[model samples]
Target: MAQAAREPDFRTRLQEWIPKLVLSPSVAAMVVFVYGFIAFTVYLSFSDSRMLPSYDLVGFGNYAKLWGLSAWWTAIVNLGIFASLYIVTCTAIGLVLAIFLDQKIRGEGMLRPIYLYPMALSFIVTGTAWKWIMDPGIGIENSMHLWGWTSFEFDWIKDRNMAIYTVVIAAVWQTSGFVMAMFLAGLRGIDNEILKAAQIDGASSWSLYRRIVIPLLRPAFLSAFVILAHLAVKSYDLIVALTGGGPGRATELPATFMYSYTFTRNSMGIGAASAVIMLMTIAAIMTPYLYAELKEKT
Candidate 1:
């Protein structure tokens, strides 16, 4: 009878402590900082506000104006450019680097660190460096002339049509290292015996990679592709630092546009609409990848 009474006490104690155990302080922090912030942003989006939050509700006025803006259009166009360039350049360069580094290479340990070190730097630093290097009058081309490589002309930063490419280049310089690491990790997982068998079957190095190795790295490629795509979609910081949507708002992107509205223009309603659009765009692009990730997890 005493043992039976102890069981009830244990159950009662467990019930009382369950919430504490399940909802940790870290979890509570996520709720307050992440989920709570998302909720606040969403709530603000539905309201009519300027400079500060106003509870007076206005429906879709912000959305209409945001859609009508030419700066917004430029942002949409540049987003496409940024995504296309970043995905293609990063994947191609990263794959090449991974394959080269995978070879029985001299100084590979040092080389790998050299490639990956850029990832440790923030975009602010990267942007500053790139701005200097690509500066029309004072940068590489000017120095090249000093070195007698006078035929070279590297002046993309000042031209409106070409400034966006400079942004893409800066982004790739910073991010390709991360993709290289991902590809290198994938390469390590591949069996060397399979590669030897391919060589025994008279496959050239190019043929071996194209036919066997590339296909095997699909999961890694998919993962990296999604990551790069998400980064491209959300890109703003590097562009802001490098160009500031410059030369008549030529390099504008969605996030930057939202920022312009929210802070610079003090059009909070339009900014909120842009934010919602950004969320929707990301969701639309990610739905397929998200489904695959979920299915794989299960």
Candidate 2:
């Protein structure tokens, strides 16, 4: 009897230990690669490291210089514009698309995939394709001229002032479908009984959606905003492929700024400072949302 009890206890202990043993590698990787590197970056930001990392401390000198630079200011301003437009435009377009799809249209399956196909492509691919389409000499403008519409002028990619909006356009095209899918999932998860009750209370279609449906989609809206905001802040590949951060630094964002200073300009300390700032910005946006989400779940 004692031997049988010991065997069961051993099996139970083995089962518990197996899961942690399996998960240990991933946890260890996150600790070493993700959080470890983040801590190293923070340390380097205060050190006088350039061309290579050095341990010599410089207090806030790097940060002061970063703040005073015109290029850094331009990157920050550009980020504000791009992030704002990208989030708002994506949310609006996605909400509309989700609502349209939720109407149970005849070809819902086919149309859904078509809308989402752009998202299936990588940002690098999307940026390269858009670059060709937006190019003045060999793109839409050239095609239009060949087809006898000589007056058509779509040269925003080369225009300094309008170049950032071109980034916005490409980003929205790539991400809005994903946002739509988020909202669509939220819409689908909503209880049908509540919707029917609202309809039975003499609520017109517009009133039904406005009061009941849209209110219930608050989580989706918040999720979309958080995701798009993070994407906008870290956006490097799309800008690199599409604008290369300019006709003249017009589309430079924090990510590009960090890379330029670190590798190209040999200002590693400043670059690390910029990276730290970007991390803080993301944390500020995410912390409250995460806390609220956790609180609600608890």
Candidate 2 worst ten-residue window by lDDT: 114-123
User: Where is model 1 more than 4 Å wrong at Cα?
Assistant: 1-8, 11-24, 149-151
- Summarize candidate 2's per-residue lDDT along 185-286 as a digit string, tens digits: 999999999999988899999999899999999999999999999999999999999999999999999999999999999999999999999999999999
Give the per-residue lDDT of model 1 (tens digit) for 146-262: 999989888878888888899999999999989999999999999999999999999999999999999999998998888898888788778778887886787889999989889
TM-scores for every predicted model: 0.90, 0.93
Off by over 4 Å in 2: 1-16
- Evaluate all candidate structures by whole-model CA lDDT and list the values in order: 0.88, 0.96
TM-score of 1: 0.90
